[model samples]
Target chain A: MDFLLHIIIMACLTLFPLLGYNIVFGKGKILHFGQEAQSLMAVYTLWVLVVQFQQPFLLALLASLLTTTMLSLLLAQLSFRLEPDGFGVMSIALHLAVLSIILNWQSVTRGALGIPRIPRGILPSSLERYALVVVLGAIAWYFFLRRLERSSFGRNLVALSEHEWHAESLGISRKKVHTIAFLLAGTGSMISAILFPPYIFLLSPLDYNFQHMIFFVMCAVAGGPGSLRGVTLAIFLIIFLREGLRFMGLPADILGPVQIMSFGLILFVAVCVRRDTLFPKQRTV
Target chain B: MPILSLANIGLTIQGHHILNGVSFDVEEGEVVGLIGPNGSGKTTLFNVLSGFLKPTEGSVTFREDDITHLIPSKRAQLGVGRVFQHFGIFREMTLEDNVRVALEAMPKELRNDMGTMEETVRATLEMATLLSHAKQKAGSLSGGQMRLLEIARTLKSGKELFLLDEPTAGVSPKMTHQVADIIGALKKEKKTVLIIEHDLPFIAQICDRVVVLDVGQVVLSGKPDEVKKSKELQEVYFGADPTT
Candidate 1:
């Protein structure tokens, strides 16, 4: 029962970040460089405040949310202002910067040693308690994203993705829309950060890195870029695949390569076979 | 008062002047035809007027407000609509979804209170004579239907000024009259329209006035008959010898 509960919590942790990516970047586009790093920074920020400063979990959560959102906004502004020559290059640069910051910010993050023994006493120290927390977070996120997806703001995002010039002509500010997307993405990441430490009881820079970022993005893209249902399904499939691979006696060192190969295969097939299904085309009449 | 006025607009592409000091004006409810041979800059003028290109030298005024530097979407918000020579519909989207996007882009204050977005889309589609094709993907539409869909989407946007770049380009001859009828209906509704067309007789039939461009310069501006009869226009447009 406890093991089952652990699986559920792990799935939620994996699912939320992908949801963040789908909402912000739209599918098929590569993941931004520093997404996992930014998520890690949020987690570290909350860990420090809660453990070192003896702050309440809710207050730490709020602070972490503000930190990550502001960081994402800054990155987004820089990315937009520079208008980097290529999406892939910009993503790599951003990710590298985040990794370096977490590695170097010894005072805040304690470098590679990691913050440890994070208190999970607030919620009953049981697997069911963790599952309940996961369920609540997932439900809240779904409701919020669904509401946002239907708003005029969401329409603007869809339009921007379809044709930037056309959307601008319609008076939708692309910069503003992008900034909001970054903020929402940060907020989602923050929620994951809060829910995460309690589950693992340890937080580190290595936990949030390019590999995890790619994993989250793969889930989003494999499910469908702009689809809520697709993203949800993708999360479970990825987790199941990972577990299945492990059960089949794959060495830990080969895990990363295996994931990359499978993702590449699936993405190639998706592009060739069901491009419309994976990245459903939107219409602007 | 003129609804839109362009003064001495010039655009140079790769150091070659495409619109050389071209100027024109349209009043409310007027349908103006811009005619020229290929490479004479009719489409270039359209691009400049619609805020898609910046004129090297000249000004564009809409309702007496200078809008030459505004982006296309801002111009669209200020009541400017453009139809491209090629249909720009989101091919994968259904007809109703296309119109819904335009309507949703309207300022919140101008939006309708219809509880359902489909209702608003249906009404606009009906106005564009596209109700029957509302569920069809825009990509699957016949060329004539696509033209109508473009016009309908523009109409749904609540833009008062229309810049149509070869509205009948690639359209079947049988459907050309249908397109002209839609433009006529827009004019009757007090919308300002500027059209670029190769069909002289069609222009004569629908345009209140015709402007002729030659080698990036305006060679004539008058009633269609007068422009057609001008010796310079006849020689330049048809390459006719002066004696002939």
Candidate 2:
């Protein structure tokens, strides 16, 4: 049962943010790499609010989500019409800039030394007590995305993905659909960020880098685009694969490389099975 | 009065003139057919009017509204519907879904009622005789059926003006007749239509006016019989000298 909780907790962590990116990805086929940036940016905001200003927890949480949403919308504005390749490049660049600021801002972020024991938890329990609650939150998020997938808004996203000109000609606004997707994606990242501190006790710049970005993207892609169930399966499978590796007690040096290599291997097999189209192309961003 | 008009429209790309001073007017409820040989700029004009391209030298006005700067979606929302030469049906979706997408953009009063939306979708599909295939994915249809689906989508999009670009490009004679019947139905409701077609008889049966373009110029415009009798149209279409 404890082992089950561990898997449930880790998989649940990735699912909320995955759904956020999946909204745009399912219809647009653009794998946004900046979600990690938004989450880390949220973390920085939460720490400053709770630690620096000594504000109440709820206010800090609200501010953090709002900041991430705005940042996401700003990114969307910059690369609105770019194709998948250009959008990917732009997202990675933006993420790096945010990561750099968080790493170098010693006065505000405490630099690479890390922030310790910032207050976390909404329920009464032990420090690592809310894995089941997190699982519930993930389930709620999954059902929400599933509902969205069948709604008019969801249909428009899919139509936009299939053919932009036709969708627009039928009166679907590309800007409106994309804006909504990005905003939702930002909110998804914030949920994961807010749920993060309770388990991670220590915060470091390393947590806000390209590695997490890849993990976030892979969590969505390996599930298959435009599929809610596919994503659900992918989340647990990836978490299990990585955690199972840790449980085996490999040497620390090879553990990191091996986890990454295993992903590459699965992705390679996926490509061979589905053809070199792991990420399908979108006409425009 | 003219519902949609273009004045002095010119498109120059990389120093080559794609369309040169093309002017025309489509009056309310009038069906106009634009015919041109390859490279004569029919599709370019469609692209320009549909908000896919901005002309270098002129403007587009719809219902007295200057819409030269509106994007494609804005133009669509303002009652301009297009059926592409390559068809615009979302092939992966069911036929019902395709029609539903167009009707999904219908005015709030009609769309808010589930029963009305269903009836609207059903009626639109039945017009093209595609009601039986409503549940199937469009990609599985034959080219002719796909063309019918495209027409059905454009029919229910709630747009007052229809741009039918080659409605019978790659279909059988029977399917072509069905398309003509569909256009006749639209006319009965008093919707304006502009068709880009190659079939002269088809144009005669539907269009009230014919505009023949050649090498980026409107060389002839008249009733179908008058345009067909003109030497200039024959010369442009056949590449033969008018006097000869």
Which one is best on DockQ?
2
User: Residue A252: error of model 1 in Å?
Assistant: 3.8
Q: Evaluate all candidate structures by whole-model CA lDDT and list the values in order.
A: 0.76, 0.82
| Predicted candidate 1 versus true structure: per-residue lDDT over A156-264, tens digit per residue | 7776666555566555666777888877777778878877877888887777877777676667667767788887877777776765676667788997689678877
Q: Write model 2 residue lDDT over A1-285, tens digit each, in one string.
A: 777777888788778877788777655665577877877778788777887678888898888977887898876775577766788888889899888888788888888877877655564355246786787898899888889877878878777777888788888888888888888888887887777665666667786678877776666667776678987898899889988999788999999999999887776665466443454333321
For every model in order, what is the number of clashing pairs? 7, 0
* Stretches > 4 Å off in candidate 1: A27-34, A52-59, A75-85, A274-285, B13-16, B112-119, B231-243
TM-score of each: 0.88, 0.95
How far out, in Å, is residue B67 in model 2? 0.6
Stretches of candidate 2 above 4 Å error? Answer: A127-129, A275-285, B109-115, B241-243
User: Which digits, one per residue and each the tens of the lDDT, describe model 2 over residues B44-134?
Assistant: 8998999988899989999999999999888887889999888787876888888887887665654665467788889888887889988
